[model samples]
Target: MAVTYLMLARLPEGGLGAFDAYESAVLPLLAEYGGRLERRLRTLDDRVEAHLISFPNSEDLAAYRADPRRSAAAPLLESSGAAVELLAVRDI
Candidate 1:
């Protein structure tokens, strides 16, 4: 079965200056890993974001996780002092 994920994040004191760059880099890469960005939402504060993502399967998810290029967003996030939470969703 396909797998889904929920992600919530809080950005740094400087706010969303780097969000566009991060999104640009990460979103395109998803297709290569059989992943999809279901939805992305940003708060009015511009200091937080959330995502709904899905993947073909656990293997695809694992491959994406293991990819070094996947860390493309890491610098933006780390420098921003971001806080991220991810949850796996399964059928009820």
Candidate 2:
């Protein structure tokens, strides 16, 4: 079954640059796993970023999560002091 996820990222004030770099590098990898980034949003203050993403199935989502490139980019997110939350969602 197709899967959708809501990802919320809380970024540190001083680490916005790192967060941007991290996302720029990693977000593209989703496509390799049959995933799409449906929507991406950010608060005016740049404190929070929200992503609406979908994958062909849960396995695809897991594969994306374990992608080597994404794992390599983890330090960037960690260094940015970003807190991330991911939730599975269903359309109404």
lDDT for 26 in candidate 1 is 72
Give the residue spans of candidate 1 off by over 4 A: 90-92
TM match of model 2 to true structure: 0.97
CA lDDT, candidate 1, residue 16: 69
Clashes of 1: 0
Off by over 4 Å in 2: none
TM-score list, all predictions: 0.84, 0.97
- What tens-digit string does per-residue lDDT give for candidate 1 at 1-92? 89999888888768466765666667788889999999999988888899889999989988887778758677865666678898997657
lDDT of 2 by residue, 1-92 (tens): 89999999998889899999999989989999999999999999999999999999999999889899999999999999999999999999
Clash counts for the predictions, in order: 0, 0
Local lDDT at 28 for model 2? 89
Residue 69 error, candidate 2, Å: 0.7
